[model samples]
Target chain A: MKKKLTQFTAYFIIWLLLTWSLHFQEVMVGIVVALIATALTRDLFPDEMIKFLNPVRLLWAIFYILYLIFYIILANFDVAYRVLNPSLPIAPGIVKVKTGLKSELAKTFLANSITLTPGTLTVEVVEDNYYIHWIYISTEDPKRQKQIIIDRFEWILRRIFE
Target chain B: MSNPVAIFLITVGVIFDLLGCLGLIRLPDVYNRLQAATKSVTLGTCMILFGTFLEFGFTSGGIKALICLIFVLLTSPTAAHALARGSHISGFKLWEGSKMDKLEEDKGK
Candidate 1:
C-alpha cells in the first residue's frame, strides 16, 4: 500500500511538472492519469522505494547529478582532444572491473556513469563484474582500473540506492 | 530569440555534433566509434535543448525542452550500452591497435 502511494506521488509529480498548470480540470485529470499509470506499473518497482524518501539519500542523489554533469563536460573535452588529434591516439580495450554494490539500481547508475565519464563505456555486466571498454588503457592492474572507473561513483551510489 | 547565451550554446552544440559525426567516420572500429559518437552527440543535443529552455523561459515549450533534455540524458547512454554489448556478443572485433580484451578473456575461461 505504501509502495502504491509512493508510485502515485511520483507519477503525479511528473504530471504536474510536465503540465505546470494549476487549473481544477487539469489537476483532476492529472490525478486520474497518475492513478491509472501507477496501478498499471505497481509491481515493477523495487521493494525499497521508500528508501528514496530519506533526506540524506536525496541530498546525495542531487550531488551525484551535479558530479555526473561536471565529469561529462570534462569527458567531452578529453574525447574531443583525442578525436581531433592527428594520430587518433586511443589505446582502446575491454577491461573487467568488480563492484561491491549489491543493488541492481546502483549498478545501472554506475554503468550509465561509466558510459558518460572520461574514456570509458560499460559493455556488459556479469553478476558483480562490469566489462568496460576503455578509450585509453592507462594501467593493466585490475585494482587501479577499479579505482579509476567504479570507485568514483560507487560510494555515492551506495548511499543513495544500497 | 535575441538571447546571446542561447545563441552561443546552440553554436557550441552544433560544433560538438559535427565532431561526433567526424568521430563516427574517422574512428577505426565499432566500439571506438560508439564511444566517440555517443558522448559527443548526446551532450551536443542536450546543450541545444538547454539553450532552447534558456531562450523560452518557463512556458510549455521550454518545459518540454527540459523534459527532452532529461530523457536524452537518461536514454542515450543506455542505448549505446546496449549496442556495444550486442555487437560484442555477436563477435564484432576491436581495432588491431587495441591493447586488451578482458571480456574475451573471460569468455575463454
Candidate 2:
C-alpha cells in the first residue's frame, strides 16, 4: 500500500511536469492516469523504489547523472578521435569483469553506463561477471580491467542503489 | 535557427551524426559498429534536441524537446546493449586484430 502510493505520487508528478498545466480537467486526468499506471506496474518495481524515496539518495542520484553527462561528453570526444584518425586506431575485444553490486537494478545500471560510455559495450552478464566488448583493449588482466571499467561508475552507483 | 549558438550546436551534432554513420559502414564488425552508433549517435541526437530546446525556450516545443532528450538518454544505450548482446550470442566474431575473447573462455570453463 505504501509502495503503491509512492509510485502513484511519483508518476503523477512526472505527468504534471510533462503536461505543465494546472487546469482542473488536466489535474483530474493526471490523477486517474497515475493511479492506473502505478497499479499496473506495482509489482515490477522491487523494494528498491522505497530506498529511492530518501532525499539523500535522490540527491546522489542526480549528482551521479550529472557526472554521467560529463563523462559521456569526454567519451564522445574519445570515440571521435579514434574514428577520425587516419590509422583508424581500434583494438576491439571482449574482456571479463566482476561487479560487487547484487541487485538486478544496480547491475542493469552498471551495464547501461558501460554501454553509454565510449569503447565499452556489455555483451553479457552471468552472475556477477560481465563480458564487455571494449573498443580498445587496454589490459587483459581481469583485475586490472575490472578497475578500469567498473570502478568509475560502480562506486557512485553503490551509494545510490546499494 | 536564428541563434548562432543553436546553429553551431546543430552543426556539431550533424557532423558527429555523419561520423557515426561513417563508422557503421567502415567498422569491421557488428560490435564495432554498435560502439560507434551508440556513443556518437546518442550524443549527436541529444545535442540536436538540446539545440532545439534552446531555440524554442520554455514553450511547448521546448518542453517536448526536453522530453525527447530525456527519452533518448534513457533508451538509446539499452537498445544498443540489446543489439550488442544479440549479435554476440549469434556468434558474431570480433575483428581480425582482436586480442581476447573472454566470453568464449567463460563458456569453455
Candidate 3:
C-alpha cells in the first residue's frame, strides 16, 4: 500500500511539474489539472528502468542539431542561388549512397538527414543500405558520395540516436 | 506590404505543391514520381510555412508551422526512398528512359 502510494505521488509530482512549466495560464490551474490527470491515468507513462534523459546522448544530439542548422542555412542559400541563375546549372542524377549505421533508428535518422538537405533526396533504404536520388550529385563516383554522406550525416545520427 | 503579398506567396506555395502531387500522379514510374514529389513538396511546404512564420510571428501557430516544416524535411524523402527501395527489391523496373539499372547487376550476391 505504501509502495503504491509512493508511485502515485511520484507520477503526480512529475505531471504537475510538466504542466506547471510547459503550458499554463495559471500555475494553480495547471497543478489542479495535472493532479486530476495523475489521479485518472496514473500509470500511463510507466516508469522505465532507463530514464528518458541520457546526458551523453543528449550532448551529441545537441551537436547534431547545431550542425544540421548550419547545413540547412547553407543549403537554403545554395538552392535559392541556383533557382535564380539564368543558366539553370543543375546536374540531375540518381545516385545510390550507402549508410553504415547499425540500428534501424540510426539508419532512419541518417536517411532523413540526407533528404532534409535541400539538394538531395533519399530514394530507397533496404535493410541497412541507402539508395539516394540526388538533384545535383557533385560527383560521378558513387563510392565517394556514399563515404561523404556516411562520414558527415550518418556519423552524427549514430551519435545522436544510438 | 499587405495581405495580397501573403496571398501571392501562399499561391506560389500551392502551385508548387500541386505540381508535386501532379508529378506523383502523372509520372510514368515510382522512382521518377518520388523525385518529383520530394523536391517539389519540400520546397513548396517550406515556402508556405515560412510565409506563415512571417505572417503570424513566433506564436503557437508559427511554431507549429516550423515544426511541420521540420517534419516534412525529415520524413518525406525517407518514406519515398523506402517505397522506392521496396519496389526495386520486389522487381519494379525503372522507366524505359533509364539507361541502366545498376542495382540489379550489383545484385546476385
Give candidate 3's iRMS in Å, 1 decimal.
5.0
Query: Where's the lowest-lDDT run of ten residues in candidate 1 chain B?
Result: B34-43
> How good is model 3 by TM-score?
0.58
lDDT of 2 by residue, B2-100 (tens): 888888888999988898898888788998999998988999999999999999888778888888898898899899888888887788878888989
Report the Cα lDDT for candidate 3: 0.63
What is the alpha-carbon lDDT of model 1 when measured against the actual structure?
0.92
**How far off is each candidate at the interface, as Cα RMSD in Å?**
0.9, 1.2, 5.0
- List, residue by residue over B12-107, the lDDT tens digit for candidate 3: 778777766765665556766666666667777877987786777666666667767767877776677777778877998766555444466557
TM-scores across all candidates?
0.96, 0.94, 0.58
Which residue pairs does candidate 2 place in steric collision?
none
Query: What is the fnat score of candidate 2?
Result: 0.74
Q: Considering the two chains of model 1, state its CAPRI-style docking category.
A: medium
lDDT of 2 at B65: 86
The model with the greater DockQ, 2 or 3, is: 2
Q: Which CAPRI quality tier does the interface of model 3 achieve?
A: incorrect
Q: Compared with the real two-chain complex, what DockQ does model 2 have?
A: 0.75
List where candidate 2 sits over 4 angstroms from the true fold.
none
lDDT of 1 by residue, A1-162 (tens): 888998999889888878989899999999999989988887787777688789998999999999999998888897799889999889999999999999888888899999999899999999999999999999999999999988989889999997
